[model samples]
Target chain A: MFKNVAVVGATGAVGQIVRRLLEERNFPAEKFRFLASARSAGTKLTFKGEEHTIEELTKDCFAGSDLVIASTPDDIAQEYLPSAVEAGCKVIDESGYWRMKEGVALVIPEVNPQDALDAKGIIASPNCSTTQMVLALKPLHDAAKVKRVIVSTYQATSGAGVQGTADLFDGSKAFLSGEKYEYKAFTHPIAFNCIPQIGGEKADGYTSEELKMLYETRKILGDDSILVNPTAVRVPVANCHSESITVETERPISPQEARELFEAFPGIQVIDDLPNSAYPLPSTCDGSDLVYIGRIRKDISNPNGLSFWCVSDNLRKGAATNAVQIGELLAKNL
Target chain B: MFKNVAVVGATGAVGQIVRRLLEERNFPAEKFRFLASARSAGTKLTFKGEEHTIEELTKDCFAGSDLVIASTPDDIAQEYLPSAVEAGCKVIDESGYWRMKEGVALVIPEVNPQDALDAKGIIASPNCSTTQMVLALKPLHDAAKVKRVIVSTYQATSGAGVQGTADLFDGSKAFLSGEKYEYKAFTHPIAFNCIPQIGGEKADGYTSEELKMLYETRKILGDDSILVNPTAVRVPVANCHSESITVETERPISPQEARELFEAFPGIQVIDDLPNSAYPLPSTCDGSDLVYIGRIRKDISNPNGLSFWCVSDNLRKGAATNAVQIGELLAKNL
Candidate 1:
């Protein structure tokens, strides 16, 4: 009745989140293996009331596992996950390594479910920022095909991994006490400031995070023609990732129609009323699985343009919850 | 050898900064009067080694004063400052109430000194955000006429005044402990998140801060034909404000030429170097008066578009320093 499961990079933020989602959803697994690098191995992690030791993430770690969730860094996920496929294990990859692959399906289950079927032993989860953007955009995109997306993100420190969160707290202390901050996780200080450049800088002046929104959205939506311009920024927020998005649609739609469409979506919440101050705030959306959408209105500058604010728990909907949903889809459809 | 000076709202954030600037620059004032409301009268403050007793601001407070700097709230500045003008004091108002007035000149001394002379006894300082923006844009607008501007700001807590900064700290503590945050200065928690709306919402969906950028740029640049659209966000930063500005110019200008123009301008430092990660950060410009400009590049999307990042100490260059510079110009010329 249960499938054998394995988790790669079991010690990471995303990996721990993946484990939490699996436990919370009561995903039936015959056996669970926690795999990490040799250096990270042998640590005891409690999952679903059982304490299991982390094993070295060698090629053999995926030998008998029916499903493998790789929440590791991109390079390791890319290099090692193909071995899992060779061992006949399906992979729900939470890294961008396999996202643009020729055969692998880049899936956001709510947005694109049918593509999950054509998965050649692997499914790619979109970037944390992209996942939330698409979730917010899909409802509106369905009402009217989004032609161009101009987005500016106020992302959290956690997206840079656990050490990034620590850097914010530590850096702020160092700054307040008149001491120099030795940068570790981020390229600069994360506390008491906002960094406009996120991810590595591209030669074309777009950051890697910005390009991921463009590339991942195109791949997931199955629409390469859609234009996306993104500027990802690292704010001091801890969990939720917020975006100020302006979209140009193929046809004009009123704010009422837009609100209706958003409210109709499964994982979207419409919080657009300004008079009552009932807009979505990240502080309110912390730990929530649903993608919170608000500030819906027509962009007065352009004929068919719409502007809105979007927020979601990056660790949940953006990472673990999405991966778990992919597993649920795999359990039913695969 | 010195003029008698009066400071309205002498206990507020901008008021404190203006006082510090006056002392730092050794502003030539033989007599100084600190004026506040009836409730705040009798409070004493020290400036330039002299203690000044705060006086209740009444109809006659402006009498015998040569120059009065009004840093009060908008409605108060509007209603009270006209009385100051009637009482024969030449006023430099730092409130938005008189900034866009028909005859009142919005002055940022480094960029538009000639505009200051046109003031009809009430010289209005530009909005703090607008002050830094036009300072960076003027050098570019001079070389190439800017037709349009699209900016997204990562503003700081200081922009909302002292209470705003306190709210951020208190809200952050409440947020981490899982308690209901008391929203004082903002409608939501400002600890780890960004708010897309700043300065109250306007009729057309743009915030008051956004509209100020639009109108003030047109006034300061002396060009009503310029089209400006801005989205202002209050990020979790403490001191400086950063803006991602995209400009559409009438003519094409290379990134290098734009860099040279900015470098030649006073109170601007160009820090564009992508390969080495040497761009302006708020920490780098925290205590400085310079408008730190970086990441100057050509916009690949539009036909004569240029993109750059502008960072400045909102309290200094954006408020106090600019006011002091205007006072210097008034002293020299008027």
Candidate 2:
């Protein structure tokens, strides 16, 4: 296909993962270029047995690239994305900026690869919180049709990027050594505590992260009628994000059916066996691209309601891995 | 009006707090006795400037006591609680064994103190997860009548008692020091994880800990018609439990009105200033009997649905302090 690939924000935490995954997955990029901010530019990252310099991410960086995987913040994605598209580059963005915008596909390759194939310019990847959620919801909704989702996320600090994961270690060391530390990566201390807000407030008092789950789920799942109520809280963990989800289906879906549906789904591994003490935990699920699902049961409150717990490495399946998977799907047809 | 009070399982984590709260809250105990299993019988604990020997718990241990506070595991409480009540002692139990038993008042004194006074022999304190949840639900349920509740808990390891807390410290130190650590306090490693299952599996694939939240909330709120769905998770924390709650009321409850209701209710302090990053965290709410709530907002899915975050010291409001409050209530009626 002779596809030339460029990665923006290629020196960030997610960018490093993308760089590693490109070689690990043997991504079909004939030519590769890395771009980051001015501070990270001129740094070296190796890909496919060749060293590549991280160029400054500017308007002109995407001139020869056929596909650009953007892992920058939302504002940066918005600022430079149009230029990438104008330069004839198809962007798979890892930001919340263009997710809900008109005509842009919010894609999870495992759940909806077809959406990515149909996108015209930029295909937006779901948020880290949203990616793992919709992946779990996809199989369940396919069979019984999900009516409502009441989810509470036990998200990790790594979702905040490199600084968030670094602060977790630094804050813990400061506390364990009896010195004082205030976490700058998060709004509150993240060493041994939980914070309730992920981003600034949005409409209806939901944080931007919470709203991303609601909106992105509908867009990626292609079901706007599905009602979602999400509470996203940041825990002290460094990697995998966990969610306790209660879903109401249009028809009854038992625990057995839910388990079977999840097991059959791609990018999902079921680790559910209660008696022998087997279930999903964020710590154990770290470093995996697959979202782990367990604690499958029926919600006692509603007859058609099902409850389950899911975990995924926020850096892998939540962001870089999924972004790479989308690039794979896009590259095949290029 | 002299009160002869006895505390059972006195050497355990919750039992130690029960002893301290008794003195710190100046519970009008004229003569105090400490009792535990035979291994801890001779150990001594101080109360009100007096040292008391721990007596071995037996059929005859409660003979001279007016009130007994039980803070043991389910099996231990089951083995000896009936004997304590039969021996003419009014007992406030902190174990899950008697919570849903017929006619055993599952009491949270701040929410339903009158239920304590109506007890025939023993009053059961709700589960730590249920304790913090109902406290937040009561005020909103009072003003708008909560019809359906969806709660996810970020419970602390201390809720597992001494061994659970010790494992958190041991596991973290082992991880930091690069030594292999196996966590016995939880089913998985508690160093940097979240375990979804608390107790063993029960009916319909739900864990015993999760069912406790469903059943206890109904009993404490005195409304079995209200639908409750809960996912109980144990986080890598030492003390205090937190909950992310989504409540559906009969009528819409605005964020402002919900805040005022929580503030007006006793044993609840509203800390919901989002602009300044004000919300409940397990770290800050330690050592208090009050349930701290914040992140109060209306749910986007349902007009009548309200969402909030709550935290409480599991040892205090969740167990010892709540049990003591019930004792104080029982004493006044006597």
By DockQ, the best candidate is 2
Per-residue lDDT of candidate 2, residues B193-258 (tens digit) = 788888888877777888888889889999989888888888877898999999999999999999
> How high is the lDDT of residue B173 in model 1?
61
lDDT tens per residue, model 1, A42-81:
9899998989999999877787788988898899987899
What residue runs in model 2 are displaced by over 4 Å at the alpha carbon?
none
Per-residue alpha-carbon lDDT of model 1 for B138-239, expressed as tens digits? 988999898877777889998898988888777766655578777789987788877877877776667788889999999999999887768788888888
Q: List the residue pairs that clash in candidate 2.
A: none
For all predicted structures, in order, the TM-scores are 0.93, 0.97
Stretches of candidate 1 exceeding 4 Å from the true structure: A28-31, A173-183, B28-31, B173-183
Among residues 3 or more apart in sequence or in different chains, the pairs in candidate 1 whose N, CA or C atoms overlap within 3 Å are A237-B192
